[model samples]
Target: MTQDLFHPHRHESHPKIISRLKRANGHLAAVARMIEEGKPCLEVAQQLQAVESAVRNAKQALIHDHMDHCLEEGSLSQQRAELKAISRYL
Candidate 1:
């Protein structure tokens, strides 16, 4: 099958990224419950921190994977554009 030239390449790390996001999602929900239950500020903050870290790592993985897999096939301008797109999140 012919690969589409315009679309970015698939990153092999996507499944791992998805799994990390899923775990973060569940953690975030639990954090909300902690808030509703009037849990200690320190505990809630720690859980929030964990959720944020998980999501951040997933995002970093995706962006790095894009640079590794997708950027290799593109023109210099395309790579710069893609880098700019992802940099806003960083």
Candidate 2:
């Protein structure tokens, strides 16, 4: 990936991406607390699911932003290669 592809838009979206990751971090901390507090299995599972979803959403947001702003000006081959590399997460 070209650094220029990301540098131009990084300032615009970096903060939002960081905020999302922080939210996910908080959710994970809550999950840990719930487990320590001996919460019911069902409740704990629900919170874990929420944490997982939050993390997944954050990852997807980052990937989407990268694709939109960074990949838009790239060659088709580069874009395809990047998409292929990220496809495993999908």
Candidate 3:
């Protein structure tokens, strides 16, 4: 949906979340490089797993931030809608 709905306040956690995502991006790039270099399957797989975990952690942090800020600011119906939308990511 909308970025404003999920990140209405751009809370303090925003920078930390961005840092996590940047790390994930770096891991993904390394994975691509490993594949291109014909690295061993197991090694590549491990790096890929790291990238996945990093991205998942970033997503979790973002959702937690959204729940903290968005839920507090909105009405009951709005909160319910936000929760429903957020659940899809989980």
Candidate 4:
């Protein structure tokens, strides 16, 4: 079987990532409502920007935590491969 990266504990940043994603989801729903209600374009765009930023930040945190937990502890080839794989998202 393949190894499990997470055992008894989860990555420390997971909680923050989940929180960010939840906020982003809420903002996205609000933006949809705002659209249907004829809100100003500028206000809608600003809220979209906030949602995008939250998602981006959460993704960054997850990647950083992965690097810390995997890259820092894996074998040389594994670390290089992992880093190369994750680099595409950046």
Cα-based TM-score, every candidate: 0.83, 0.79, 0.87, 0.85
CA error at residue 71 for candidate 1, angstroms: 0.6
Candidates sorted by TM-score, descending order? Answer: 3, 4, 1, 2
Local distance difference test scores for all models:
0.85, 0.80, 0.85, 0.84
- Winner by TM-score between candidate 2 and candidate 1: 1
Q: How close is candidate 1 to the true structure, as a TM-score?
A: 0.83
lDDT of 2 by residue, 1-90 (tens): 655754754647778879988998998898889889999989989988988887788788787777776666668998889888876775
The lDDT of model 2 is 0.80
Deviation from native of the Cα of residue 43 in model 1, angstroms = 0.8
Q: Which regions in candidate 1 have their CA more than 4 angstroms from the true location? A: 1-9
Model 1 lDDT per residue over 1-90, tens place: 125879744657988888999999999999999999999999999999999999999988887777666766677887788778878986
Q: Tens digit of lDDT per residue, candidate 4, span 1-90?
A: 126667544777788889889989998999999999999999999999999988998888888888777677658888888799897886
Best by lDDT: 3
Superposed on all Cα atoms, the candidates' RMSDs to the truth, in angstroms, are 3.8, 2.9, 3.0, 2.7
